[model samples]
Target: MNATAVTVFHRPPDAESFEAWLDWMGETAFAAEGFVECCRAVSDDPALEPGFSVTFRSEALVNEFLDSAARSRVLAEGEALGIQRKSSDLVIVEGELPPPGVGVFHHSVADGKAADFVAAEAELVTLSATFPGFEGVALFCRGDTGRWFSVLRFRTAQHLSDWMRSEQRAAALPALRAELTEDFSVVAHTTPFGSTLRTVDGRTRVTPTWKIAMLVLLVLYPTVMTLSRFLGPVLDENGAPPWLAMWLSQIVSVALMSYILSPAVAACFRRWLDPVDGAGWRISALGAAIVVVLYALTLLLFATVKWLHYWDYNR
Candidate 1:
């Protein structure tokens, strides 16, 4: 299998049409070339413009699509839509599919010690690199949450187990354990599980980014409030709201949070659910993207539901 990296860049002069056009182009261009693992994402800073990046795999038999006449047409379509053509680049990279016996170690750290977890991870990476059949290491942590999550891909479980049992690896454990509030549990998976791998068109998108961001916020928000309440002095208390007011406030809060948070959540979905390559027929990236988009769309659905409920109750 040949792994190709495709990056399309466009600065939406207008935020209004940015999302619509992005989705349309992704569904058409990437999907046409069988590269559906795609995301049209913007940075959280709000100052930076947005861009789309996607990667897909092609076999020798059908690899002509990258250089075919259809490629020209797609380029033209993108230009007609005001997308900057020069910003796009397509190149083939050495794509690796994890061989069987790969184990993914997922860690969720305590309240405010994610940095310590990350420090430990760096050490683990340095130590593990010496092991045989170590394909690569990828670490993901959210800003809102203190917990750290990562996936380590290895050639075989035996390779990972051997590294895990090493004395050198053990020698570094003291520092990592000292930072942790409690012992971290490690899960060994000989195969990929959960919703981690999905293929779209012919491309595989990585897991989404938004989910990771939301997870962080989920941890950080409450932690901040708890700290403020316990560490700081509370001066005054307002009158408590009635039950109806409380429910209304909660609904409104949820709506606002989802609206502000949906983009990052979608990004996370795109990042994780992406495929390693186009080999099996288990699930497609289009299907996964659709699921992710729908999940984000649920925010609107919830808002509508609440609106209807409010109307009925008021009437």
Candidate 2:
């Protein structure tokens, strides 16, 4: 099942009491088996509803929690604590985020004008409402870094383009540009995807070439081992069990050689060829090459080991 997270925004009557209640709810909800994490943060203004974000692994789990008696009891306790339900909207989406890439854009502004940054980011944040399929904005400022990062998430490619092309937003850009110094105007994109796959951020790691190689190996490996097993019985050979020993030998050799040489070999090829520019092609080629090398190395290692076994037994 795909991972899912639900966010509920509600305005509470009492600010202090509402925050305390949210904290309690957060702790209580996390005790559930499917709960991955949750956060309760005040909205930008008291007028805006306070926000509660709950993360879970599956929709089924979320539904189970909502339908259970636990939810009823929790609602009762929350009501006693003065927490009331506000308007809620649910967004369901599934897609992988590109590697840890951050896009940066900057504009110059007048000196000693710091307040303009607020108006600037406010405009950017509004793109979610202004443009189609805009998800949200994460804006950050670092005095030490002397730079601002505004990360925008969108549900579709068209949504991203809408903000980029809006003439009204373009007109407002000058005011934003007026707030930065000479070196402030800049943009950068960085990709970070490796190891663990995340629901919001992680995408499929499998490539087409890798898929093909795996299919070939799946058939070839088992067939060869099965044939070897039958041949051993027909030849009346005795000692090690052919199928089990060969299968174990193949798996071990492949893993060992792959760990030792795959990355280095792939890097060498990348440097030498330098033909692939797109991420998809580069990744696909690397994956295919790695699988082929792994399979070939497995055969070499397993054959060497088997020959050694035969010679040792004969001696």
TM per candidate? 0.30, 0.45
Evaluate candidate 2 by giving its C-alpha RMSD to the native, one decimal.
10.3
User: Model 1 scores what on Cα lDDT?
Assistant: 0.47
Cα lDDT of model 2 by residue, 1-315, tens digit: 333333443455677887777676667667767887564432553222355555467766766655667666866877776777643323222223322232223333345554566566565455435667655543443343445434444565455555566776667666566677753422211111112122211122222243433534634563455444444344335455666656655665455334533333433433222222223666656765766776787667657665433334433
Best of the candidates, TM-score: 2
Give all candidates' CA lDDT scores: 0.47, 0.48
lDDT of 1 by residue, 240-297 (tens): 3455445545554455445544434434443333334322344444544555565566
Top lDDT: which candidate number? 2
Q: Candidate 1: which stretches are off by over 4 Å? A: 1-99, 188-315
Deviation from native of the Cα of residue 180 in model 2, angstroms: 18
How much RMSD separates candidate 1 from the native structure?
21.2
| Candidate 1 to truth, TM | 0.30
Question: What's the CA RMSD for each of the models?
Answer: 21.2, 10.3
